[model samples]
Structures are given as C-alpha cells and as structure tokens.
Target: MSVLPLVFTSGWASGINAYAVVLLLGVFGATGLADEVPESLQRTDVLVVAGLLFLCEAVADKIPYVDSAWDTVHTVVRPVAGAVVAALLAGTSGSLPELAAGAVGGSTALMSHLVKAGTRMAVNTSPEPFSNVGVSVAEDLGVAGVITLAVFHPVAAAVVAGSLLLLGMVILVFLASRIRRFLRRRAQRREERSLAGAGRHRPHG
Candidate 1:
C-alpha cells in the first residue's frame, strides 16, 4: 500500500483532533485493523498517552471560550503531530518517501486546523451552549468515522475528507461578518456589565 491516502485522510482528522486520531490509529493498528501503522505508534505507552489526552480534549472541546483557548495553544501542535504520524506511516509503507509524506500530512493538517479554529471562533460568538456541544460532538464523530474508513477505504475517505474541508472553508467565509458582529456585541455587553458593577461599588457623595 502507498499510504498516501491514509496520510491525507489522517492529516485532515489530526487537525480537528490530533489526540483522537492518534488513539484511533494506535488501537486499530494494534488490533490488526490497519497494517500500515508503524510499530512506534502501536506501543502500549503511546496508546495510553493518546487515550488520556483524547479524554481531556473530548471534555474541553465542548466548552465555549475554553475551546478557543485550547485551539490557540494547539495551533502548532496539531500540524506537527500530523507530520510525525505521516512520516511514521510512510516508513512502514516503504514505497513512499518519508519527507514527502510528512509535507503532505503537515500541509493538510495546517489547512484543516485553520478551518477548525476559525469555525470554533465563530461558534464561540454565540451565547448558547448547545451549538458548541453539537459542533464538538460532530467533529469527534467525523474524526472517528474518517479514520475507520481510511483503514479500509483510504481513497474514498480522502475524497470525503477533502469535500468536508472545502465545505468548512466556504462556511467560514460566509459567516465571517456575522461572527464579527456577534463578538462585538458580546464585548460591549461585557464592558457594560463591568461598568455597572463598578458604579454599584462607588461611594455616594
């Protein structure tokens, strides 16, 4: 197997949820579901770490502002993880060059990461909690489904992943203005609240 399709698909998944991708790939590879996964990724230590991180991410991802902060911290982490995973898969495949695989994986991860971060920022502008939770759950499911399909049908999974990336980009572009307006209103409300609180504490002349 070339591992190219897997590289592309995993990269896309990694951007949205690197820890989940790691956990899924490690579990699948360990259980004989994916043969192209490298031995390094299948180690017990790696799986344990990935599992814990994924658990933490799954919870934090549903929170409103917290998720945006988390995304800021992981702007670099996701793409690097994607490149490393791609390089490892390339090593196992033997047919693909490791550097080339890493580049493809890293670039795809970067693009998807941007999309995820942008969407989350837009979503955070909303005061309701349900939308954030809904989006987070959908991302988790999408990552899991894509990874599972990549193991058996890499090409098809890659196509699906690509389509999703395009759709996300379009949505982000269309909603940019609304996101900005929502954020401004939220900030103004917060400032007013702070001013009101200060006024209440002032001494009467």
Candidate 2:
C-alpha cells in the first residue's frame, strides 16, 4: 500500500492535535508498533519534545480563552508539523517525493486547522468552559484513534479522516452566519453588562 494515505490521514489529524499525532507516531515507531514510520521521528529528543507539548495542549485546550490563544500560536506550528511528519513518513519508504508529501500534509492540516479554530471561536462565545473542554477532548481522542488506526490500517483510517474533514467543513460553512450572529450577540450582552455595572457604581442624589 502507498504511504500517501497514511500521510494524508496524519496531516488531517495533526490539524486537530498535532502534538498527539507526533507523540503517538514517535512512540509507535520507536516501539516497532508502526514499522513504516521514520527512525528520525522516533528519536529520544523528538519524543520528549512532542510529549511535553502534548501535555501542555492537554491542559490549555480545556480552558476557554486559553484554548483560543493556544490555537493561535499553533496556526503556523501545526501545518509545519504536518508537513514535517509527511516528509519523514515519505522518507521511510521512498515511495513518494518529500515535496509532494509535504504539500499534501500542509494543505490538509491548514484546512482542518481553520475548521477547528473557527469552531472554537464560536464555542468561545458561550460563557461556560465545559463546551471548550468537551470539544478539546473529542479532538484529542480523534487524533489518537486515527493515528492508531493508521498504524495498522492506513487506507481505512484515511477514508475515515477524509470523510470527517469533509463533514466538518460542510458544517462550518452551514453555520458560519449563525456563528457570526452568536458572537455578535455575546459581545452586545457583555457591553450591556458593563454599562449596567457602571450605572450601579455612579453617585446617586
């Protein structure tokens, strides 16, 4: 089987949780669980760095505004990571050229990352933190599951990942207007609260 499918799947997964994909691929490759993964990715230094970043994401992703900030920082990081992962994967087999692999990985990661960031922005309009935590957990699990499946069933994993990416993009487009209105309403509410609070604090006759 061509390694392209697995590369695409991993790239898509990286958009959601790049660190998890990196950490898992490193551990799996090092442990001989995923033979097609590159040795370079399995190095001790790579694993440690990926692990630490994954841990940081695990915590930051659960918080409301913090998650957005984290996502912002990762806008460039995730796509680059995806491209790097793809290049490494291609190097393992020499089946695909590194530039082509990198292009596929980087573009897929950007698409999924945009969907993720947009969804998070809409979720942030809500004052509660639970939704953020819930979405973050789901993304983390999705990344783990897809990567695990890619180790043994790369084709199947790619199909599933592609379907998911399509569905997410469709949903995001469908709800774009709604999300915008929701955010506007939330901002207006916050302004009203601020005005009310100011009135309460003013000196009265």
Candidate 3:
C-alpha cells in the first residue's frame, strides 16, 4: 500500500522515459543500459518527486528576498522528501514501517536543512554581497540540474550526485578552515592593540 502510492507518485511525476533514464543512470550509469535491452523502459515515480524537489529549491533561490523566504519553506519540504524516501524504502509492509521511515526521513532532511541554512548565514556575513549571490545562484542551478538529470537517468545521476556530495564536503571543510583562520587573525590583532594601549598609558619609567 505505502509502496504503491510512492511508486505511482514518482512515476506520474517523472514520466516514463525521463524517469527510467534517471533511475537506470542513477543506479548503473549510462553504460549500464548500453547492452541488449527492451525498446522502451518505464520510469519510476520517485523520479518525478526528485525533479519537483529540485525545481522547487531552484526556483526559491531565484527570488530576491524570496530566497530567504524559500529557505523557510524548505523547512517543511526537505522533511517531506525524507518521509517519502523512507516510505518508499520501507516497502508496503505496515504502519510501523511507514512511520519509522517517515521519522528517519524527516530527521535527515531537518539536519541537512539546518546545515545548509547555517552555511548560507555565514556566507551572508561576508562583505561581498555579489559573491554570495553568485555562489547561491550557482549552487541552485547545480542542484536543480543534478536532480533533473537524476530523474531521467538515475545511474548516471547517482554518480553525479555522489561526486557533488563529495565536492560540497571538501568545499565546506575549506570554508571552515578559512573562517577559523580569519577569526584567529582578528583576535590576535585585537590583543596586540590592547597591549600597545596599556603600555602607552604607563608613566614614563
């Protein structure tokens, strides 16, 4: 029962060809379908869900202050994605299974949303608004493109997604290190100024 709705929804959203391509590519890569195969393949319902998710996020980022507003909206959207993913994974087993999947999915999405929100907040703190805006747009496009492609070719999408995740992690680490260094330098400068002021205040002796 749970699985059926999930499958149906994903399929209806993805359409046949695009969805199949996304799933197959995500799982096996383009080469995975190179060999002998049926003339036509069916798409999975999950692909549609994924595509829509990507589209929503991308669109949200485009609007001026709306990007911030959209982030708030994702507070709800991400968890839903998680729940859907969980339900689909749990199979149509039972209520307990569905609930458990939803719980896990919701939690995962929440955590991811927090991290993303925090990162953006930190980026916004920077003096360069243009950099922040440009980076934000790039991220939105990249995420949207990957999700769209993944729905059409899951195997290939999987590979691209995995690579993207890895790259994001690396970039995050680098940003964190830079932030730390910047803070340290600022602290050191403050301390030096304080010490120099104290010395100047002393009577000539």
Candidate 4:
C-alpha cells in the first residue's frame, strides 16, 4: 500500500501528540513491525528524545491551564514534526514525493492542532480537572490506536483519522464562544497579576 495513508494518520496523531507518534513509529520501525517506517525514525537517539517528550506530555496534558501553556509551546513543534516525519516516510516509500507529503502532513497537523488546542481551551473552563484528565487520556489512546492501526491498515486508519479530525473541527466550531471566554479570562488573570505586581513595587510615601 502507498505510504500516503500512514502519513496522514501520523500527521493527525502528531497534532494531538507529536512525541507519541514519533516514539511509537520509532519503536515499530526498530522492532520490524512496519517496513515502511523510515530508518532515521528508528534511531536510538530519536526514540530517547521522543520517549522523554512523550512522558512529559503525558503528565502536562492532564493539567488545566498548564496544558494550554504546553499547547502554546507546541503550536510550532507538532506541525514541524509532522512535516518532517511525513517527508521521511515519503522519501523511503518512493511513490508520494517529499514536498507533497510535507505539505499534506503540515497542513493536516496545523488544523488538528488548532482543534485540539481550542477544545482544551474550552475544557479548561471546567471547575474540576477530571474532565481535562479524561480528555487527555482519550487523546493519548486515540493517537496510539490509530497510529498502530496505520501500520497494519493505513487506509482504515486514515479514514478513522479523517473522521475524528472532522468531528473535532465541528466540536471546536460549536465551542468557539467558550474558547474565546477562556482566552479572555486568562488574559484578565494575567493583567490582574501584573497590576498587583506593579502595586507591590510602587513607591511608598
């Protein structure tokens, strides 16, 4: 089968958790489970870095505002990883070109990342952190499951990934207001803290 489907699946998964996708692909390649995986991805150093980052994300993703902060930091990281991985996959597969693969992966990842970030923004509005944990766990599972399936059944995994991406986009559009509110509240908090700090440092009579 063409590697394009796996590229799409990995790109979608990367938007949710880039490290997980990279780590899993590295392992799959190292273990000889999927021959289409690029040799560069299977390197020891790559796996180590990806594994550590994945662990960090596993923890940070369950937090509330922290997850948003982490997402903010990853806004560029995830899409870039997706593009690089897709290009590598395409380079080895010999059908799809690297530039095309990179474009597809990067764009897909950016859209999915926006959806994930926006959804988390809305979810963090909840009073309790339980919902955040639940959502994070679901995302981790979804990424892992789909990526694994992509190894064995790329087309099927791509279909599932596309469906989930569409669903996430729809939910994000519906929750646009809540996400905006979340942003406003965060900004308010920062401004308040800044004012309080200024007050503390003000000259005394």
Per-prediction TM-score, please? 0.89, 0.87, 0.44, 0.98
Worst 10 residues of 3 by lDDT: 11-20
Best by lDDT: 4
Residue-wise C-alpha lDDT for candidate 1, range 53-166, written one tens digit per residue: 999998899998788779889999999999999999999999889999999998899999999988988888787988999999999999999999999999999999999999
Model 1 lowest lDDT segment of ten = 177-186
* Candidate 4 error regions (>4 Å): none
Q: Name the runs in model 3 displaced over 4 angstroms.
A: 1-77, 85-115, 177-205
Encode model 4's per-residue lDDT on 44-137: one tens digit a residue. 9999999998999999999999999999999999999899999999999999999999998988898899999999999988999999999999
Better of 3 and 4 by TM-score: 4
Determine the backbone clash count of candidate 4. Answer: 0
Give the TM-score (vs. native) of candidate 1: 0.89
Model 3, residue 169: distance off in Å is 2.5
Query: Who wins the TM-score comparison?
Result: 4
Candidate 3 lDDT over residue span 1-205, tens digit each: 2332222222222211122223442343223532211122223444456456555655555444445456666676655655554454444345337676566545544554544544554454465556556766766545446545544554565455445445655666657855465456557868999999999998995
- The order of the candidates by lDDT, greatest first, is 4, 1, 2, 3
Show pairs that collide, candidate 1.
none
Question: What ranking of all candidate models by TM-score puts the best one first?
Answer: 4, 1, 2, 3
